[model samples]
Target: MNIKIPLPASGGLLLSYKCTAACRHCMYACSAKWKADWISEEDLVNILSQLAGKILPSPYGPDNIGLSHGLHFTGGEPFLNFELLCNALEIASGFDIPSVFVETNCFWCTNDETTREKLLTLRGKGLKGIMISVNPFYLEYVPFERTERAVRIGTELFGYNAIVYQVEYYRRFKALGIQDKVSFDKYLQLENRTDFARNTEFFIMGRAPYRLTEELADLYPRYPAGSLVHMPCSPPFLRDWHNHFDNYGNFIPGFCGGITLGDCRELNDLLKNGIDLEEYPVLAYLIQDDMLGLLQFTVDRGYMVNGDGYYSKCHLCVDLRKHLNAVDGFKELKPDGFYSNLA
Candidate 1:
């Protein structure tokens, strides 16, 4: 099947990679120990401005027009720098983005009075939605009541639809009794639960490969070599309508994590004139969805496996990218954390 690249309709700004609590499942391997600066107001303004330009105006009436463009702010903990997070929301609002959301671990919520005050302030600043991260990994450091409190506050301020509870994949698998025999199709079947919780899959990148893989080995059902290639990319890259911008205003394509596609400044140009994925050799191989082919390609490029078999296709893909990232041109494709022992 030919890979289809879709136009972006929504974007996520990774406010910063610094977090108050370090979750083992974090794809970015963020923690208090990680040294990264918060995104500047100027950078946020530039990114939102460029994003606003690419958003095609809706032909429908005013009520339906703003829905064409959406924006969300996330991070190791967006609340770590509350001011910056608020500033980002303000900017997105200024651009008339239909939806402005924020994802947080809710570690900052101390009490009902405090949480209500903070969330109400954010709501007044144009925050439209709130996604509270809740799972076993987060529960380790964050109290359940904190998440509950944040949820309550969010519902009161943004209404029920605006409040979302994001549960990690492993937790969902365990909840649905599919952990022992994993299947994506099975996952899809149970995705329609009426509960506020939304099942989110773990990307076998960052700390997950090292920190959580072995412990959950029995939960991961492996695919035969090259079979994953034919398996459709989740969110189907064609419908990957979202783009992620990091602290430096670098655009990370939704289909290609860690890899920086271009700067946010070039977003409008790239969107107007779509990119040729094949131009980036690794990305080209990636979109083909052939894990065995990708492995062979890596081997041909002087990579040797460490005798450790991967838990899944993503496991193998991440390992391969770690080696490819060392090559001069591909170095910036993925972040350095993917190649390090952040755990």
Candidate 2:
């Protein structure tokens, strides 16, 4: 049983929410216009049950289940699915699973008592961490007050476990801020090394696709593609971005009938129907085989740079980003127990 998430990173669950704010460059285009589906409390919980290491096939032993780290939740805004989100946290807490984290745009977080209470709710769920996306591009759509409120709630709720990521991708790229690009000479001497800038291809997520013009695509090549990098691609995350239900529980995105390649509901169906995500070829490359050959492959192929060398890390597919954006890039790719028996 080759049961494993291809990338060596944490097992993540992506839940897309429909937001009131619609930005120009949205990657998944998670907004009122480009709405994806929201997973239900029932389905999301069921999946967690599977991840608790019981339902899913376990190539390694049971201890490997709890030994795994990092259960990340990202989306249009996790807060949009407050009820289900809460369910997930509380369940993870019940299981004593650590690293229950979520990434958000801070739009729904507010000074309202309900919001404070919700943040407080996560505390009970082993919510050891939270990442706030503070991209400058959101300045036009997201109110700073919302982010400020989220930060306050985060610190009060998750305490020292909160992290914030830079969101001003367009401006940074527009300014050509390639500080990481300056380290070319140090690692290139090794003939096979992976760094943040080496093989990175620039991928625009969250509001970028709509705003991306022909002129920008032309400009994308000017950036550097670092070398020898391996990271998670978009299989899992893409699989999970679905439609948000009405306050009543109806997925409003798309026809709610069609299925995208990586959407969660469809993935679930695939599972029930006997298709295993672990068996996907692309997934196998990143998550299996001790996680080193992939890194070396990236190094050998000169893909360690962000976007095939021309774009930023965000531009790559989600799974691709997971593998590349891993802490320390190549080195962070770990060899889980599942690969211990490999030759």
Candidate 3:
């Protein structure tokens, strides 16, 4: 189970503290509804000021990409702050050292030519390209045309540039539109490479924090709370985060930080006024230490826990509400097979 991979050499940069669309399944439902515990643009500037001796700003004068240790711009929707995103990229470009990646929904990639042009341009200017995140749920709001356009822009326009494009399919419900899922699958299939197994992920968490309706808790028809599930989070900050809870209180790692499950003994001081109750609305966070993990998980590490087996890993503090609505078995919509080494 110890799938040791390379240490993350990059940082998940919070570009803009906002998103445009409010997808139902968004783990935190990350919209204008919340703000992350990030150093501000000014804070970044100050950090840069102190680290000037170690790094440089973008290759483009006053350009955003130049300055950084390596960085990835993810958020409510990093593209929302396209200008700030560009500025950050300029800063990275200045340093000319980091390989930056953007985790985007790809919705905007198709609508605006300016955004498209900027992404394409970044390919040459040290931009690592996009992580075109797609899934069956995405089809609800993300039109087929847009997802297709995103692929074209990321692969074709960027000239088959470096990109991640993680996709996940759900097969739990037979009610979801078949055609929409099919179209989405085909789109991701084309984007996947031979080495990579799947272009998607089923790692639960996002907006709609665990939706445990009476119907869903019936995984075995009679039993409730079902079985536990867990995934190991590979963020360098995991132990650091776990320690936060053990010594202080029931909590989450800063990397996957969301809601704290118990008393806010020490974390309150680190956060704004109080714990980030706004983003993580799960009651699981308030659970006792021993049972805190009943509803938690981290990504990058593996194991598929389900109704038959017990849950694993710490997921309570994070938002898993959306995934709680149903588990995916993904079959009829199989357009492509993601090449996972294990799979």
Candidate 4:
């Protein structure tokens, strides 16, 4: 059977995988250790042009254009490359793309003047909003003051457009009176909790499962390798509503890390021709029979199942992809670092 996203309603463009901090639970495993490869101006133009031509699969609001469909600039952190981010916003504006925003950890917000200056520049370049990341993981690297400053200034400028990714975390950080970077352990101690993973929202893929196993294992019951066989992959994988395209040209469907539907450079062609399951065996198995099917396929190819039971189907899925990725046979598992950075 062949499959395609048809049309994605919303998506993000990853400026780069390089970040100021390496959050342990990051879905894409973005870190400071990543290479400084960023999206080229030409590639950005090509992507935005193609995106500008696409119509939403489901229309919303006054315009049905995909370019205005919740498109945001993201990365290991979009703010890391200030110039590229500014260029991207300007280019999107040239294309008449509106409602574009940027996601950030606020690590660069050193003071009120700098923050306001940067925000004003981006807004002038057609930035519609900002999503400030605030959480224990980010608090481990960025000062809470910077995040607070960003929120305050951003809300002042963008009004309701400025969004705290998780206002709950913002409130918690304020209540704690956290001023600077702190270790996750120390934050947990201050919160009087032994674990925070159970309360956080993140996908168990990329470096997350491997790096956070200890924090999550005890909280959730583990199951043997075949435990998720009967479970089908989530419906989101078959839909194109929420997705991300990376600097490396891979189109990540439904935020399923390490899984690439195809190259975004040829996105129009892929959408027109549809994906041949024969070319993407991992996605094929997953679409046909879920993670269990993928496990069976890989096991036949000599994948060794670890003795430790999986905490969820997502955990097992990442484990299976990690093995397939290391083997270097599957072309669908992408960005290489998604698996290699598991350490």
TM-score of each: 0.78, 0.50, 0.51, 0.92
* Model 3, span 1-343: residue lDDT tens: 1111112233344443355545544543355544433335654453333223322223432223311224456665776666666666666656553445566766665565855777766665556656666554455445655665666666665443334344333221122333433433343344332312243343333332233212133331221123332223443322221121211122333334333333323223333243343333333232222222434332212323344332223233232322332243222111111001001
Evaluated with TM-score, which candidate comes out highest?
Answer: 4
Residue 113 CA displacement from its true place in model 2, Å: 4.3
Clashes of each: 2, 68, 64, 0
> What C-alpha lDDT values do all the predictions have?
0.64, 0.44, 0.40, 0.79
User: What is the full ranking by TM-score, best candidate first?
Assistant: 4, 1, 3, 2
Top-lDDT candidate index: 4
Per-residue accuracy of model 1 over 294-327 as CA lDDT, tens digit each: 7787888898865546655655666677777765
Provide the lowest-lDDT 10-residue window in model 3.
Answer: 333-342
Tens digits of per-residue lDDT for model 4, 1-343: 7776667657889999999988877878899888989999999998887777452422443122233356789988998899999999998878866467888999989999999999999989988788899888888899888999999999898887787877877877888888889887788778856446445565666666677666546665678877676776564465656588899999887667788888887888888888899888898876666676788777887888878777667778888888888876688899898777665
TM-score of 3: 0.51
**Descending-lDDT candidate ranking:** 4, 1, 2, 3
The lowest-lDDT stretch of 10 consecutive residues in candidate 1 is 60-69
Error of 3 at 190 (Å): 20
Error of 2 at 183 (Å): 33
Per-residue alpha-carbon lDDT of model 2 for 1-343, expressed as tens digits? 3442221223445565455554444444455543446666666655565445322211232122211245666655677777777777777666654456776777676566766776667666556667776543454556666666677777776665566554343234235432222222322332232322233333454334225423245444533333223434333332222222222122222211111223233334433453243534333453342234444444554445344342432333222323343432332222111011111
Query: RMSDs, each prediction?
Result: 6.7, 13.8, 13.0, 2.8
Name the better of 1 and 4 by lDDT: 4
